[model samples]
Target: MTADSILNVRWRKASASDPFDNCVEVARLEDGEVGVRNSRFPSGPALVFTRDEMVAFIDGVKKGEFDGMTV
Candidate 1:
């Protein structure tokens, strides 16, 4: 879904985001899913993920499974 289409939701970014807001934002959707979008493109398309999917992704993140990819 498009980020702008999911009205009335608060999108949050990481606390360590740059001053220019170069980071992704996430919001809890009405249907218990999660919406993720780029902070630089608020009106851009958002990827909707189920709660379980989100949980798995977060778990992987905590485990550093995606580490070193940015480099």
Candidate 2:
């Protein structure tokens, strides 16, 4: 969905985010989808994902499946 479509939603970032606000923010869309966008660009585009997709992604994160992605 377009970023403008979800602007009314409450976007939140991780509490552990750096002071520079260089992190992604997430919000729960009205249709049960999850919206992800860059905290540094609140008015930028966003990626929409289904509930199940979010669950899988979060699960993978907890399992360290993306640990190698960082330098």
Q: State which candidate has the highest lDDT.
A: 1
Candidate 2: count of backbone clashes, pairs at least 3 residues apart or interchain: 0
Off by over 4 Å in 2: none
Pairs with backbone N, CA or C atoms under 3 Å apart (clashes), candidate 1? none
Model 1 — TM-score against the truth?
A: 0.96
lDDT of every predicted structure (CA atoms): 0.94, 0.89
Q: Tell me the tens digit of each residue's lDDT in model 1 across 1-71.
A: 78999998999999999999899999998999999999999999999999999999999999999998788
Q: Count the backbone clashes (under 3 Å) in each candidate.
A: 0, 0
- Compute the lDDT of residue 37 as modeled in candidate 2: 91
* Candidate closest to the true structure, highest TM-score: 1
Query: What would the TM-scores of all predictions be?
Result: 0.96, 0.91
